[model samples]
Target: MLYIGLYLVAAGVGGIKGSLPTHGAEQFDESTPQGRIKRSTFFNYFVVCLSAGGLIATTFVVWIEDNKGWKWGFLISTMAMLLSIPVFLLGSGFYRNKIPNGSPFTTISKVLLAAIINSCSGKTTSNAVVNMATSPPSVSTQKSSDTKSKKGQEKTSENESLETQTQSFKFLNRAVNNTPVYTALKCTTKQVEEVKVVLKLFPIFASTIILNCCLAQLSTFSVQQAASMDTNLGSLKIPAASLPVFPIVIIMVVAPIYDHLIIPFAREITKRETGISHLQRIGTGLVLSVLAMAAAALVEVKRKNVAIKHDLVDSTKPLPITFFWIAIQYALLGSADLFTLAGMLEFFFTEAPSSMRSLATSLSWASLAIGYYLSSVIVSIVNEATSRGHHKGWLSGGNLNRYRLERFYWLLCVLGGVNFLNYLFWACRYKYRSTGSKK
Candidate 1:
């Protein structure tokens, strides 16, 4: 029953969270400069609001769970979720509903199939050449050929008039080629371009996963690390789970400063809206994530040394080291999240095809999900390998004091450094589809 309830809740939450960002974005018109800026601002504030909610959870909800009960905490969360529905519906009349025309996947599949067939067949047949040179003359046949030739030329001109196929991925352009066979296949230029946009984003999306894997440490090992530390605050004992409040508070403070102060200053200097480009914002987050892991590793080393000095190696009691050290890494992680998550939301929303905005924005959430899964896999592998011969595993037991967490943090720091380099490679090469005009 517990498993069943968990699965159901996961499915429900996933559906709601996936659609919410796109729904909020659709409220703003993207055709105008004002609308685009508003949309970008919305994404930033959306993250700010999310962090605010997280702050409440880490503090109030955690306190309730610790003092009152878990049931009371769950009840409060359910009430909030229920209340948000009515609040959302109140704005329904103002929202511009973008109706689905048809499944974009069908068009994408057709383009893929047509491209494959065109490549396999080799050399496109020229319809204009066929029509112009094909006959023993009749006045009627001559006139028909002339009309067909004009139509083919007009079609070619139309394609040339719009944005040319990007130099990269020239192969997909076969789907939109003017060849007789490709024309019969009926792939539109817009559809081909949409596929290209997705292709370009793939590398950028994959590079962020390693950063998220580092982040997953916050929810798991970070909490455990805190659990084994002194969590006293002015004679009040704090829960280890509430340590996430550090990052949430950082985001709450940094987000507004970034939006109001940093963005306006950046806009004046760069002469572009949104202050910073989406990729630049994401890259900033990636770099900070590396620093956050490094910070975590250093703190862990200090904590471990203190624990060893006090002879708390096998003891379950909290070490005398201040929990403030953990807060340093948490603060960095939060600031990093503020940059990457908002940038990802805006980037995907702007760059995705109109029909696929929802799906594309969902990739931000999906990356975090993948990172958590990867973290689990890495932990398992690391444990198995390290727990051999005379060596005890880096993350072996319930007692974190016995665990070599500093080594694990250093590993993440190294992984984050490599991932940042990978992100820079893709980000430097990436061309924005919507914000292309912005310097």
Candidate 2:
């Protein structure tokens, strides 16, 4: 029953996280600088609201579960979810809901299939039918059935083109042959370009997965490390689970400052609406994750050293080190999340084709889900490989104090560094759909 309920909750959250950001971001005008800046603000507050909810869950709901009962915790959580429905509905009249286009994935699949099938139909590939590569006909004009007058209008529209056909993804360009033996296999230049945009964004998506893998450590081993330390703050005894409150608080505080103060100053310096590009913001977060893992390693080393000094290596008692030491990593990772999560959300929404904005934005959450699973896989593999020859793996010991967590953190640090370099390569090569910079 508990597993069933958990699955239901996961379904609810998946629906909410994937749609809400795209819905909120699309409210503003995409054609203007002010609208773009305001959209950025929308994504920022979306993250802030999410953090606020997490804070409540970690502090209030957790307290209820611990001191009152699991029943009370469940009740409070259900009530909160119920209350949110009406609140969301109240904004319906004002919201800018996007009209549904046909499924984006279906279109993407059609383009790829058409590309593969028409790759070698050389008779159809000609400069004679139309120079679809250099001067593509608009989709609306093309759909009207090419009359002589409509053909003239298409030529006129081509002269006043907003975006030329890009040279990259040349293989997919075969999908857009000027003439084709099978009409069903013919793809429009717009369709081919949209697919190109999605393919280009994929590397950026893959890069963030490793950063989130670093974040997974905070919930798993970081909490365990905190539990082994002094959790007392003056007169109050804090639970190790409550350690997330530190990062939550940091997120809530930093988000507003970044939106209002930092962004405006960046605008002044860069002479652009987005003071820092989305990729640059995401890169900042990746750099911070590397720092976070490095900090976690050093802190673990210090904690282990203290345990050894106090002769508490094998003791079940808390180490003399403060749980606050773990907060340093939390704070760093929290800041990283603020940058990457919000930046990726806005970047995907802004850069994706209008029809695929929602689908592209969902990749932000997908990366997070993959990262967590990767973290577990990495842990298992590390244990299996290191525990060879009947030796204790770095993470295999029964005792948390005996575990070489410092070594584990350093491994993550190195992985994060390599991932950041990978991100830089993709980010530099990526051309913004709006700006059309090939580099």
Candidate 3:
């Protein structure tokens, strides 16, 4: 029953998550300079809200579950979710909803079919057929009604010439050529270009998966590592799960400093809007994640050495080392998350076609899902391989003190370093669709 309930909740979240970021982003116009800046700034604040929510959950919700009961903690969460509907409705009047244009998927399918047909026929589409495809339905109707109108004929000619000159994804552009066999399958130039934009973003999206795999450690091994260390702050003891609050706090402090001070300084030197490009921001996060994993490995090495030196490796008691050592990696990971997540949100929203913004922005969540899945697979493989030939796996034990967790952290650090290099390769070659005011 608990598993069923959890599955239902996951379904509900999956449905809502895709729409929310695009809906919030639609509030700002992308045409004006100020509007673009505001949209970028909104992405930063979105991360701040996420960090604040996590902070509350790790502290307040964990407290309720620990002292009161699990039922009460769940009840509070359900009430909060219920209250959000009314709060969202309150802003409906102010929203600028973009009306539906025909289905984008249908348009994409037409482009594909048209391309396949054109390829098989081995015949070039003629100028007349191309003109018909480029002209609007209304313009075609007017031409059929009054074939003798010189101005209408000239206007159609101009549009056809412009459509033929489109340079990107030239093969896809063939779908708009005016061929008798493809008259019913023709797509608009804008529709073909939208598909091109989505294709370009695919590689960039795939590159971030390994980085998320590194981040998966935060919720699992990082907490366990902290659990085995001294977590006392004077007379009070800290919860292991609540150790994530360190990163949340760091993000809260770093976001404002980066946005207000660091960005202004960067803008002055670079003379570009938004201070750093979206790709650059994402790259910065990738580097920090590498550093975070390295830091985790080093701290684990120190902790293990201390345990071995004092003959405490086999004991159940917490090690003499402070939990603050674990907090260092958590803090670094949090800062990396802030940079990468905000950059991804803005990049996908701005680069995707207006019609596909919601679908594109949702890729950020999908990457994290894939990352978590990859982490489990990697762990299974490592355990199976190591358990053979009388060697215990690095992560196979009930006791973390006995586990060689530092080796696992170092492996992630190496993977992260390779992923960063891959990200740089794509980010440098990729072109931005919108340059705001500077371009």
TM-score of each: 0.85, 0.89, 0.87
lDDT of 3 by residue, 85-168 (tens): 999999989998889887667777887788678767775544453435564669777668476554455445434544554576
lDDT of each: 0.81, 0.85, 0.82
Model 1 worst lDDT window (10 residues): 125-134
Encode model 1's per-residue lDDT on 71-124: one tens digit a residue: 999899989989998998998888888787876677668778878888888855
lDDT (C-alpha) at residue 229 in model 3: 89
lDDT of 3: 0.82
Better of 1 and 3 by TM-score: 3
Error of 1 at 179 (Å): 9.7
Q: What is the Cα-based TM-score of model 2? A: 0.89
Off by over 4 Å in 2: 120-164, 177-185, 435-439
Q: Which stretches of candidate 1 lie over 4 Å from their true place?
A: 62-72, 117-164, 176-186, 436-439
Which prediction has more favorable lDDT, 1 or 3?
3
Candidate 3, position 118, lDDT: 78
Cα shift from native, residue 122, model 3 (Å): 5.8
